[model samples]
Target chain A: MSDEKITPLIMPKWGLSMKEGKLSDWLIEEGTNIAVGDEIMEVETDKIANVVEAADPGLLRRRVATAGETYPVRALLGVLASEDISDADVDAFIEAFEMPVIEDDDDAEAAPLYEFAETSVGRLRYAVRGNEGPVVLLIHGFGGDLDNWLFNIDALATSAKVYALDLPGHGQSTKQLAGADLSGLATAVLAFMDTVGVESAHLVGHSVGGGVAATMAFDAPDRVLSLSLISSAGLGREINSQYIDGFVNSVSRRELKPVLINLFADSKLVSRSLIDDLLKYKRIDGVQGALESLSAALFADGEQKTILTEKISSLDVKTLVVWGAVDEIIPASHAQSLENADVQVIQGAGHMVQMEQASQVNDLIKEHIAG
Target chain B: MARTLSFKDAVNEAIDQEMTRDPTVIMMGEDIVGGTGSPGEADAWGGVLGVTKGLYAKHGDRLMDTPLSESAYIGAAIGAATCGLRPIAELMFLDFLGVCFDQMYNQAAKFRYMFGGKAETPVTIRAMVGGGFRAAAQHSQMLTPIITHVPGLKVVCPSNAYDAKGLLIQSIRDNDPVIFCEHKNLYAHEVDVPEESYAIPFGEANIAREGTDATIVAYGLMVHRATEAAENLAKDGIDCEVIDLRTLSPIDMDTVYESVESTGRLICVDEANPRCSIASDVTASVTQEIFSSLKAAPQLVTAPHTPVPFSPVLEDLYIPSAEQVADAVRKTMAT
Candidate 1:
């Protein structure tokens, strides 16, 4: 028996609720040399469709899971081994692979999906992972929740303690807002950190959330170790008012589906369940008013009300601004507004770059936080 | 904020929340506050299925246990509606509507129109409908089409607990009189429902499942059957879209038209009898409006034009089954 290393590309569990994913297409061919963070295949979950990136570099020896077929979480999808590994050994490895059994009882007892914290704004819902190292907080954009960082939370948690929270008026948090402006949201985030006993943390935010993170960093620089903004708002004045208005007014699945497509480069990523979940959230009482108030305060007349580029640039904290090259909601050009910050405009992605290119975004964030 | 709740509990919660929010909201029904004069438990039966079981305790005397006089109480509820009170009268079973048709169709339904828009009848008539508990003909009639046919009345039949709560809230707040049809068989069916009160606007159909091959339209308990059929058909490579027509009156023909236009096939699943039923009505509307979009003649999967049978086996067959819906979808696919 030769000591040859082999890795299995398993179906990734995106969020706490994701049980399985349909392997839609293989992006890379077998026999291709794989690098860490390389896009390997596209997987479709009930919520959204996204490309699965490689976590370990190796030779792509075999593709076991067929395209268009769904596999349970942690079920082996492909084999990644060196050229020295025999075909017989690869076949045996594939045959012996057992899909991870996720016992509902054990899982629920082990890690509760989310926790609630009573903040000054209202009751906030959050998910905390990891126990040691520096703390990192994730803030999601308008109409988003902690689940927006589904792909990144666990990855970042491998290095640092990570916390992702749904802002007031979003997710399972209170729909009543203390205040609906950007500063109001920043205060809520600060209150959440206080309730959770997080003194200082690296802030990773997306879109409106990015603006909130920047505001937190500017107000209390000592509390924010570093800032990683992904397709953030408040750096520019021009905004997709149509998308905002449509999202606010849409009451049916048909009406909301088209509006959500503006957030992703691949429109097909907006699956039926994604729209349904959003519709469910939107239908909650007081949610409509809360969203309307936020939109009015932050994005009045189809333009961003607050521009914090100068303020964020002047801050001494380490900053990283990431944008999707094809971002439609807020122009990717706003990424260049920062004078003394690292900027990365990723190609083939849109406003939701953190989700679309999750592996790259995760790597960048992990490195930035570490630095 | 959302947790699993049965349809029975959801309906109760809707009424309870509405009553708590607005002092003008009141409920009157036969045995709704159960054991009223019996000196036993004050709020005993809580309607036949205990849907309004604990509500009386929360909103005391506001939940009046009316005598078994449908016409009188229904008329009184409609008259109270014109005068500020938003009354909800539980009509027990929809089959009992024959005794109180005039109070609903002529009085409550035509209040605003006949009174030259000066009157507003914000009354909701809650009645249990459909078969499958062996309730037989008199009790398990799907009289939605009868109520929906009227000009001014808004008719709603929710399939699940979430829809039940939201639609019920909307019905209570609606200015026009509403006939809220509760499927007795689906009362125990559970789904995640938010505790807070929210309203789902009428005339907007929910796409229960998305597909590209065919479209199946249904409401009430039939929505579940249609969805099951779509899922089963999916295994056989026959993708079908299922639309839940939550409200019958002010029907969402636009949604039906959009689905049919894409899939180019239509199958309407309704628990009501076939003749002049909602199934036939939707089929006719889709065929007439988007004639060129259809690749095949639309099909209707509904109970045969006969009273609901009492026998266990016959009653099981009397209601439209998932198998029947699948067969209808398969026929459309073949065409």
Candidate 2:
């Protein structure tokens, strides 16, 4: 027989935390042509559901995994190669495929890499990924934290130092507000910047985080090289008071799911686990008071209170404000409210445009940082 | 005249006072401050109910307003608790708990026990509970039992502003995760609340009224209902003892057992719905421990096994009344 070849299509790991995933559906038949990045199948993790793109371009020789089956990380799902690839070769390749187990051991290596540093403001917990580049401080809006950029941070950090943080009252940082206004948040961000030893870098903020970024840039133009605002809060008067009220007032799953759904253009992005996560946070003590103070400070009567139109206009730092066209938390029209800012209203995303349309936001952030 | 504040204001004062007293104590929640970057004002409603009003001015960013995301913030509060920041996260409404219960049960509640007592989740989750605001079904639920069942978490449902302030302060300082249930209906209900910060320890039942014939145990707003029933019961020449199980999770079983031993009759008045409720839990525990001492079978005055109704009439009939509590007490007394 002529030389035979085989390719291993192992179960892929999409994120740092994913250990196992369920094969949601198979797009290709048992034997079919597949290419790299091809829509081969769908996979569902506990957190999200996404298409599993093909790793190697070739004919899908065998389907070892079936729909609705659960597999550990790196488990061989199938084989892929040219038509000349023999089944015997595929079987041998499968046998050689190393199924790496996600060690259930709780002895976390390297101290979990996440730590909280206490400062004058509150406990600012941050996660720094990648060794080197211009640091990108990811600030989430009103009730958000470092994890809101779960999809974008790692992708953005490939070329730049990515720092995802929990604001004063937002995440593992501290629930206490140093001040309820943008300056309070801005100061905390600066203190966090100082604690982390980043002299100057990019400020990437979403929603209310947009306001914090603007404050940082306005506070010290020398320190902030670039500003990336995604569905920010500072440039407009119209705000979704109902969503804010619903978010603040909601305590049950039924109440929070709807409010959270209002955050994304794709309401389906708000999953059960997502709602469960929010409930877990809200149930913690002091969070209610901190959120109430923030809401009253940032948005009252469901309208934006801190308008920094002129403050951000004259800044020499490269400014990029991205908004989802369907953004509801802070209207997409607010993107136009900035006169001198480079505003891009992404067509499909909502308030969390960075998450919904991450590639564009990441590209915009990268390009703005380069400038 | 009794010096009083709205339930919202009283809660705000409790937080402000506690934060003032203890620098380690901190507050976090969504939109506790009204205006962030808008044109008009700052500290705009002081929360949806305006409970956290003026805290931003007093404590600065220490009174934080988070993004509308509860998981990140609440988990952060629990996280901060382990790191020495006594975080009090406002859940807004108890109904919204579905969004962040994991932080409460799996994380905060389990942290101390899971870590083998090395950690203390000194976190207080303040959430508006019960129905009366026309908040409909989702916004209105007295699901205290759901939290009370979880060990390692201290649950407090104060009936009045006095207990609200004191118990909230206690929740802040307590070295455990506490789910503080705030009855939206009782926020405006006034009572004399001391300005000084003091903590009422958990597992200590407050004897609202002392009597001889029957013992009525209740909590949250139902304490008032029990008091009112005790008043009517007094008129009927049937003196009743009322005990508020101040801390439901650490529940003063000793007080219940003692009362049962003294009176030989028990009636549990709970605002929560019947079915595996605190009432049922208390009834079952009481019967098991104090069955020999009981002269009569225990009675439970609670909401029906159904969702909190929206109609005024249905809601009015939904919650256990003072009359019903007294009647339950009277029945136990007769038996």
Candidate 3:
């Protein structure tokens, strides 16, 4: 069998939610010699479009998936093999290929990846991926769940034991706020770390979650290895309060669609399903109250209640601050406020740059962690 | 990483996650575990099409391979659900509902209502439905309306893998019996589904596409077709809003009513036969509720009132196409 020689170029999985991606175009056609990491195809997911780089070096034998057609993750998009392999063999291989069944022995006995940790703050839902590595915790913004890190978590998990948590008042966690203040939310993070038995972790937080992360770094410097804030709050006083107010007030699709558009540079990214998902989250029994309380606590006067810029430099931990240039919620200028932190303002990205430009952000985070 | 999974795999993931979450959650169906008594691999087949494959390894006895008797096993599953075990009974095909529907509607569906709300039958009847499989009349049928007519039962048909996972999770967690109709044709259709278990609430319609010219309501495989039609319609200057009614019993009529009020045109597309189907049901509701708002009468594009033909050509014609839906929208525009 020439199976050992033929390397399948499959549709890459970007996040936990992405099932299939459209092959927009193939950069390296059949019969082209390709090296590892060479750009081969442009794949478009519902969330973003990314180039599929070759993982194996060989001659591009065949492009099985047609351009503009979508294929499932791991479905053979193309085949690369030695020039010695005939077309007939490649055709046979493609015809006989069945999607391999996933069966990892370690995975079978392991606890559910997404587990709830009981803390004094409340029951916090956290997904822990990669069993053995440095601990990394992802904290999402106000109204956002652990899903905000959907793109980054798996990517970061490659090098670290990543944990993305839904804070007390958000997601599937306890809805009732104990204190509802920045400190209260920070304490939840601390309690969650203690509950999960993590002595220290690299904290990557977005929006209000970044505020909570900063507060945690200040409260217990020993517990935080490093901090990476992405378009985070607490760096500036001037915030797009209308965005916050609109997010909190909009209950219907008509009202919510426009509100969500502010989060992205390209309003076209505000998909109907995205709006619907938010509506569903909002409709959860205690979610409305939780969101309202959190919003009030964080942005009481249309400005970030706590500016941690002064204390950020004082913290002993290494810090990285990333902001979207067109961030409507929090200005990219806020990235300049952090005295001791390395900052990058991603061009053409809005508030949700971590999601909007996940690959770039993921690369940044990976680089930061490695450094 | 976000992995693309077929509708079958999504269904499997939902059941697996639920089983892992709750100890009482169990699954039973003929060939679900596969190779029950015959001399073959223990976990072979995994259902008629392998939707429930590999789950047996994780859950073990909780994932059961039942006898060939649908009436007996489905009844047992329903009875078990009433007695604390949340049984997910695979009905194999919706067409087989004839053999065990009494157990479904009469017993499981009615348990909570009839028992004065004391009983909770948290049973999910997972079955493959719809035509285009060339499975002939008996094996292929969108019998969603038959179950949706029942007051106590919750009917759900997801158009994609993401909804399939979430809705199935909701169905299993729900205290009432849920008939989850998996369009056989859509089994291979892939979409992004979260690894973590999340529930999409019942009755919330997903607006697949937003438009101002017309509103197209559909579910299951037809939702995809409606979306295709909406895309085609867009090129011709018709912005058609396509709504996937993810759940039938607790239908989001509010969304439909709102859409029709704005667009002044409604087109319902269902793969199910035209007579008293979901399309007709939506048409009737919209016509009655928003008759004054509508610029033209509501149009319904559905399969003809006949058995699903075996021939590929006949079956292709029998299943309502995107072109037909677009034509219906055009007709609404003309009126």
Q: Give fnat, all candidates.
A: 0.87, 0.00, 0.07
TM-score of chain B of each: 0.98, 0.95, 0.98
**Per-residue lDDT over B98-196 for candidate 3, one digit per residue giving the tens place of the 0 to 100 score:** 999899888887888888989988889999999999999999899998999999999999999988988898899999899999998888889755455
Worst 10 residues of 3 chain B by lDDT: B191-200
Model 3, chain B only, scores a TM-score of: 0.98
Q: Candidate 1, residue A242: CA error in Å?
A: 1.6
Rank list by lDDT: 1, 3, 2
Q: What share of the true interface contacts does candidate 2 keep?
A: 0.00
lDDT of 1 by residue, B1-335 (tens): 77899999999999999999999999999999875465588877888778899998899989898888999999999999989999999999999999999999988878788889998999999999989878878998888889888999999999999999999999999998999999999989999898777889899888888889999999999999999999898889898999999999989999999999999999999999888899999999888899999998899999988999999999999899999999988888887
| The 10-residue segment with the lowest total lDDT in model 3 chain A | A99-108
- How many clashes in candidate 3? 5
lDDT of 1: 0.91
Clashing pairs in 1: none
The true-versus-predicted C-alpha distance at residue A56 of model 3, in Å, is: 38
The lowest-lDDT stretch of 10 consecutive residues in candidate 2 chain B is: B192-201
* lDDT against true structure, model 3: 0.86
Per-residue alpha-carbon lDDT of candidate 1 for residues A65-143, written as tens digits (9 for 90 to 100): 9998888889999999998889999998988888776446346467877889998888999999988899999999999
